[model samples]
Target: MTEHAATGPVTRSMAVPLGAFAAGAVVAVLLGVFGRVHDPTLSGTTDLGFRTVIEMKVVVSTVIGVLVVLQLVGGLWLYGVLGRRVPSWLGTAHRISGAVALLLTVFVGYSCLWALGLEVGTLHNGEKVPVRAVVHGVLGCAVFGAVVVKLVAVRSRRAPGWFLPVAGGMLFTLLMVVVLTSAAWYVATDGWPSRAGY
Candidate 1:
């Protein structure tokens, strides 16, 4: 038997990915913990010269969600896991899409935290808050953690081959949750800033 055949399945150390995941989770928790809830009226007025922050978030988040879907497709193509031949430029495209997704996510996340803070109940209108809002808030924090773990797994030589795909999937799922709960809900409920609940 060859030397390769003699050894069992290889396994890489998980320290780097684990540590990175922990760090990311901590950062996310800190933001939620320390975030100060403010009046939506004051925060809602923050605009990018032409549009309010809420409008910008809705548009940006929708674009990011689309890009994330592309990232999934590109990743699968690059790995040849979907039965498609790996294009020469697929890896580059995957990387680019992932970077753009990350950047957009970061922007939206910052805007959400800064403008809305970590909120759950419907204190503004006395309406019962939907479970989707609470889940979205929780998953928003998880998105940051997932992103950090994915970044570390992608960069670490000691990370196992399966680590990257799993991390990427987790990140994608979290983003979808955030997008669906916030942007999709906003679109379905209210088109723009006609009221103060989104």
Candidate 2:
């Protein structure tokens, strides 16, 4: 009976969610570990016209945070958490916004990884990165991991109905934390750059 217990319907049904959790954990750990070990590029040029790469990352992170809020609302609407009748257009909009938010986050993540690695005690603008930035780096990696869970759960027919909503909420929460720790904190403390009114 104990042997079959592992193969019970509830357990079988939970495999996808379990797989998702493993995938997220692996991705986050790999990225964070790699960042800590890699030799950062340390220099680059951007024609996108931001006053600094830091500013660019901050702005994009903020935008990603805003889009995450929309995602939470859309997910609720689609799941009938908000009410019964979801608009047909909501799904498409949700997909588009989610894609954009993901791309933006990837851009920021790539920039951070390539230019600065995990920061830790690394000097930036003549000072070591604060603890919040280190927290942001780790959490930022976790956001992409959660995104992996959400994406797989969203696409997998075998995934339990609750998986999608839970994955989405997790992603939303991680992103909000990542944004708060980095972009929002920067804004609250330092404000915008003199030339980066954007």
Candidate 3:
């Protein structure tokens, strides 16, 4: 009876986000599998004119990092963490930043996943890649999944008040991991303007 009491109330509020997140998780899992299964030797480059796809990705990811920082601060402000009164312009700015960041993230992911997928061992793209590349791939996939969860949580009327904040924070954390692994690592090892000619 106690177990039933705990689990039986699977209300619409709970079910919608749960189901939405599960679907998003599936998308992430499929992306990870694609990264591993795809031919790493196959090469493609972005027309954006960076000498390599990785450079383009690093540039995009860097922008995304800045955008997420904005999102975090704005989120805190909106939640009254920074102040009692929220700015009228802040909510719109937050939404815009989030949307742009998500789009840029997708662009980077698509470019990387298509051109290189996941690299293993030494000398994949004329450069040595470490295990972190694989880890980055996994985290990259999770970001998209988290994005879906956040989007659903945002739109769900029945979701608890705390649910959206928790979801947004989690998504931001996941994205930072992706940025650190790919963008920060690339800049540190290769320099700010990547030798690949960003």
User: Model 2: which ten-residue window has the lowest total lDDT?
Assistant: 42-51
Question: Which residue pairs clash within candidate 3?
Answer: none
TM-score of each: 0.81, 0.85, 0.83
Query: Which candidate wins on lDDT?
Result: 2
Per-residue lDDT of 45-98 in model 3, one digit per residue for the tens?
A: 463666667777888899999999999999999988897689799899999998
Write candidate 2's Cα lDDT for 34-124 as tens digits. 8899888846634256777887788888899999999989988987889879988999999999999999888888888877788788575
Model 1, span 67-184: residue lDDT tens? 9999988888777779977878888888888898899888888777777767776746888667886788778877887887888888887787778888888898999989998888
Clash count list over all predictions: 0, 0, 0
Lowest summed-lDDT stretch of 10 residues in model 1? Answer: 36-45
Using lDDT as the yardstick, the better of models 2 and 3 is 2
Ranking of models by lDDT: 2, 3, 1
RMSD of each: 5.2, 5.8, 6.4
Root-mean-square deviation of candidate 1: 5.2
**Model 2, runs deviating above 4 Å:** 1-12, 42-47, 121-129, 194-198
Task: Kindly report which residue pairs in candidate 1 clash with one another.
Answer: none
